[model samples]
Target: MKKGSATVAQLSEFDEIIDVRSPAEFADDHIPGAVNMPVLDDAQRARVGTIYKQVSPFEARRIGGALVAENLARHLHAHFQDKPKHWRPLVYCWRGGQRSGAFVTWLRMVGWDACQLEGGYKNFRRMVIDALAQQPATLDFRIIGGATGSAKTRILEALAAAGAQVLDLEGLASHKGSVLGALPGVAQPTQKKFETALHAVLSRFSPDRPVYVEAESRKIGRVHLPTELMEAMRGSPCFAIDASREARIEFLLRDYAYLGDDVADLQRKLGCLNRIISNETLARWQDYAAVHDLPALFTELVDQHYDPLYKRSQNSNYVRFGDAIHVSTDDLSPSGIIAIADAILAKTPVRADAR
Candidate 1:
């Protein structure tokens, strides 16, 4: 790379990555680990855009330039005051345009080694998309398949804790993959952000070792999986978990105790299934929720909704589901889950071809 510019491929060569786009743009998506130091804030950017459209480009630039200078001075005193003179940073805006150019020029004049991203965040976004489309094929993945409430996520966590590579999609998405999967007081990330996170995690795994991930639908709540990754997971070998129904219900009751706190919201989430479940059954479930009879509600939900749906989706989507190695357990306690993870690790061997 040159003294004044770097490419997305050279991200790690810099001491810090700075995003000079507005906060809104940064929140939507940016290069992972990049810090936000917007030259123009959300309101200022909108104001400048309006001026450029309604008044004149020169007028907008004049006003925006002043605002950018003021913000840069604030950042210098507040954020960059303690930085060493030898610090090197990569700075970028939406495009390799005026905002980042101005910031980089200022930093360079201040005696720090600063470079602008050649194509800015647009380039990084392109890199993320391309990586997601191609990277899944490079890794060896093992799918953990089970009906809802079978502690698949817990098992994946245990696998990770046991020094195995694990990708917890639900943990990434912030929503469990179900109708009741919406977590209270938690919101899902934008689809682009989710893909960025997924790409980051996938990039870290060793191809020679198998990555354990839960079997997820194409969409987890509002965010959808990359088509290539979904295909990769669906075709991967699976470990089917067959925990007893009673055990599953008990597990769910404990895992989803938050749902019991808001009976009205729980009923509303269940009402979403009115189209598939008969009115009488829906009423019965609603009544159970109204009375805080979680055990009955969970049991009915598993028997009627979750189990049947899991059977159909797993069989149809997972190509290797028929040949899956079944792992049965009546115990989903913490120790038992670890034992299960240990057993799976013992059975799974690293692939020589992955290297």
Candidate 2:
């Protein structure tokens, strides 16, 4: 790993990295693959921000600087003190400002090889947005879409495992693109980071290979897909993943087990629907959900919201991924999915190039 100031290009060699920005700022956006390890907790950051606004930038820096130093020492002694010798860390704060610089300085003093990112997360975000907005001429895609419980992602994974050139969009995205899509106890990468992650995956696969992705809107939670990729996806051909409502409900429940009695999170994810569904109706649904009315809730959501959107998007963007292989509830198992994929593969040429 390279030591000292780390340029953005140089930072790419690492398999992973740490983000020192406040989690709130990070939740808004951050570098993909960078895990949050905030130097200052939320309260401390708020306190510092207040100081900066009310007092002077100088006073805020003086006070915040001391606090940061203490946090760094604690971090080193506790986490990095006895780890690998001279480890290189890609350090960053918002806009590559004082916070990351402070952390990198402390790392060097402790005999570690620390490289701070130039222009920090902001520059990285710009890079992702630029790449996404103006994707090179060669990029191409094939979208995988089905109703809410169609297991499109599992099929994509199976295809990848089977030596097909594939792009696991959800994996890179840290989202499943639904009310229950978020992984348990893990935060999502920033929107720009998500685009970067998508770009990284897309760049690796041959443009001629039918890159498979789920049909997703421009936004995943707070993150937005890059315009280029979104356009690519919209135009990309698709294989319709079909499944019975019963099977879909089971799959969706298992996938969303993490929410575990947190109906509020579900409502929040549902967004505008909460406004549409009367409180009494919601309470009834929640009660049903509590009593294993999962299929009903899932079916209602698909019928009411997901299905309508999917149909509209598919009807409008049918030109991109031109083929459709419908999957069934009987195809829920791994072999079943593979069979469907193989059946689709058999009908089409292997190296079907896209634009």
Candidate 3:
């Protein structure tokens, strides 16, 4: 009767991790590496649910028990028949209740050392939420601040490559943290998934070392930053990157090359700003796209929209913006970004104990 805690380290001790929730539940979110071996699949769960609501509980249990028994037989015969007697597995369902209990009963009956997660996926999710609410306060952060097309993301990557700890918010959210931030054909994860991913990354860093991250507003696309983390970032020391106008435009053209391939998507994104910018202005931007004049359109967009918006919001949002260490680069190329990463590391002192 081995028992596992809801913590990641405790859960990682098992030989195999099995999730018994329905496919849809697993799809929405689950422990990162747990294998899905649903006790009742999506359709079966729905059918059982319908029976429970529309029919008598007694009748529903009768039908569900028969279904469960048949599914268990198939799993034992098809999936577990080859396994040895001493196989150890961690099993869990929604709330560490009936579904996992039933599965565990059968597995133990078959002579396997199977254990149930004490609180299940719900418990794991709660742990992540609580961590997100509290953990950022323990970390020391250095934010990277700059206007659009400043290659902040690229610089973060280079820093990570140089053995510095970095929290890439944009990468985690799968949105570039702007109006045109959404990556084409790549969908963002659910909020729960994002939080889970964030927790995983944060837990890996030591509290003593500074985490380098790009400056982001509270919201990144549809997902919002954890309140504690947002507040910490606003007050943290920052590195302000300054690049030339020509350099920024060139950098953007390369970074957002997808927009050129699908001009319609570009126009659609531009149209979203109709409320702030006039319809005529949006139409003009669309016309620029119609002729594939992205450089021209992007230049105007930064000067008219992104730059002004950044100037107004950043100073107020990030309290330390005025004291940010300025890192100016005339080149925004790959080598240039690596050079910028080197420059930042040179000025930014890693904590004495970080080594």
- Clash pairs, model 3 backbone: none
Runs with alpha carbons beyond 4 Å of true place in candidate 1: 352-355
- Pitting candidate 1 against candidate 2, the one with the higher lDDT is 1
Per-residue accuracy of model 2 over 71-186 as CA lDDT, tens digit each = 87787777785556646677888877888888888777777677788888887777766665655345555567777778788877777776777776677767787666777666
TM-score of each: 0.96, 0.73, 0.93
Best by TM-score: 1
Order the numbered candidates by TM-score, best leading.
Answer: 1, 3, 2
What is the lDDT, from 0 to 100, of the residue 285 in candidate 2? 64
For model 3, the superposed segments whose C-alpha errors exceed 4 Å read 1-9, 351-355
| TM-score winner between candidates 1 and 3 | 1
TM accuracy, model 3: 0.93
lDDT tens readout by residue for model 3, 12-117: 7777888989988988888878888888888889898899999877887888888888877887888888778878888889989878888888998888888888
